[model samples]
Target chain A: DAGITQSPRYKITETGRQVTLMCHQTWSHSYMFWYRQDLGHGLRLIYYSAAADITDKGEVPDGYVVSRSKTENFPLTLESATRSQTSVYFCASSESLWSSGSPLHFGNGTRLTVT
Target chain B: GIQVEQSPPDLILQEGANSTLRCNFSDSVNNLQWFHQNPWGQLINLFYIPSGTKQNGRLSATTVATERYSLLYISSSQTTDSGVYFCAGALYNQGGKLIFGQGTELSVKP
Candidate 1:
């Protein structure tokens, strides 16, 4: 596909297990983001990468970690998954901040369950 | 941090009916976007209206940035349009992180 893709469309893991969600974008966009969607909170950003080797925390970054070693890929890892970490994860990409013809695009999302 | 609120958290409509969705923001924004999350969990971008009005097919969106509000209109709704509609706002200097509203879940019946 020519757009963003997420691996492990659905996952089930134990509370102490480690899980990694993979995100890849073909556009080589400069910005990539990881967000978790919960029932009442909507989509909250967990981490974002502006470029290769640069990353920052968003609203909720407690149990999540993200790295953008390559512009085409941004993967999120859970150090030790907790039951509260269960949610649908979405990956997004964009060329720049409010740039012309560079709207944000999102993946289909990965449903993760921490038991 | 910006606060985004959407009205009528849930909506039910019959096919061929029309509907309007509203979004309000707490602060100034550089950009506003409307998205539709289909039942399959795909977030499809509907419009990127920071200010002014835009239309695409049976969907149209208008954003009055100065007023810190935006509206999305769905005309002649179809069952295929059943999904969660979200409106997100990008802060003026926030590095493009989008603050999304809780969303309005729409259910269309045939």
Candidate 2:
């Protein structure tokens, strides 16, 4: 409740199904991000939100969707889960732009598996 | 788009040893950050050194924006320090987006 929190610590879904991961930050930061971590590629950003209702796609955002209806919550939805989409997801937030004064704070991360 | 590259893809060290990890960015960056992913898969921000030197305990970081590179120094590393270190770069006011390097996998043996 104090810092960033991610729901469904571990999840398993079937292909072609939809899954949603939730992220909530009590700090009410202005910036939020969603990233997926794979073995060889390290971590690639999925999407990021500047503020409430303002969202943009990141490097790998083809099958993912993100919505930030409120400043404290940013949720990522997988329209149709695929096997390649199974990876660890991390949610982060920051007060200002990413810098020493306002660095991004990360969540515990969610491990998702698609079968 | 900026590209981040890390050197010495893997490193092994004994306890109490010192190590330096390097990150090279392809282009100019206004913001740079270092993160440590522990054995438990927890990602923690070590520093946000955009263009200068900053230190915290045995950990210190330096970023040369002109050279498009950053260095992370760990002194007297412990077994608990074994983990993956990553450096990311981003443009100024780019809405909090970062291009992350592949990361350095450090293993400190006791």
Candidate 3:
């Protein structure tokens, strides 16, 4: 309840269907990020939000979309799920942008499978 | 874009042993962090050492920004330490985007 939480721990969706992964944090961090992990590629950033209404693309933002309407929530959306999009999605948050030596707190992650 | 590389892609050790993991970067970094992903798939922050050395409990980390590398050391390993260890780096002007390494999978057998 005091940390970051991800919903739908596991999800299975068919191709061409839209799926959204939810992330919520109680700390009200200013920076929120979405990352996808695969076997050979480690963790690749999908998107990150500096604050409410300010978002930017990361290393891998091709098919994923993200929005942060509030400081406590950042949601990632897959417009049309594809098999290649199957991976473990993680959500992380930081208190500030300055390198105050603060670490990113991560959620348990959501496993998404596209069939 | 910066590139991150980790050494010893996989490792296995008995309980009470010690191990070291290394992370190398292709360019300068403004921030560096080490994370421990437990067997249950929970990513826990181990350290946020951009430079110099810091120790906590049985874990310690050192980052040489000038050399563009970082090292994580685990002492008295336990079965609970079994998981993947990742190192992420952020460039100075990259807007705090983290580029993660492939990670080292460590298994500690009791």
Report the TM-score of candidate 1, chain B only: 0.97
Question: lDDT: which candidate is best?
Answer: 3
Q: Model 2 chain A — which ten-residue stretch has the worst lDDT?
A: A96-105
Candidate 1: segments with Cα more than 4 A from true spot: none
* After superposition, candidate 3 runs with Cα above 4 Å error: none
B1-110 per-residue lDDT for model 2 (tens digits): 68889988999999999999999998878878899999999999999888889999999999988888999999999999899999988886565677788899999999
Model 3 — interface RMS deviation?
1.3
Q: Can you tell me the DockQ of model 1? A: 0.66
Q: Candidate 3 chain A: minimum summed lDDT over ten consecutive residues — where?
A: A95-104
- TM-score for each model: 0.96, 0.97, 0.96
lDDT of each: 0.91, 0.91, 0.92
Instruction: Please write out the lDDT profile of model 3 over residues B46-80, one tens digit for every residue.
Output: 99888899999999999999999999999999999
Model 2, which residues run further than 4 Å from truth? Answer: none
Best by DockQ: 3
Residue B44 Cα positional deviation in candidate 2, in Å, after optimal superposition: 0.9
What's the true lDDT of residue B72 in model 3? 98
How many Å off is the CA of A73 in candidate 3? Answer: 1.2
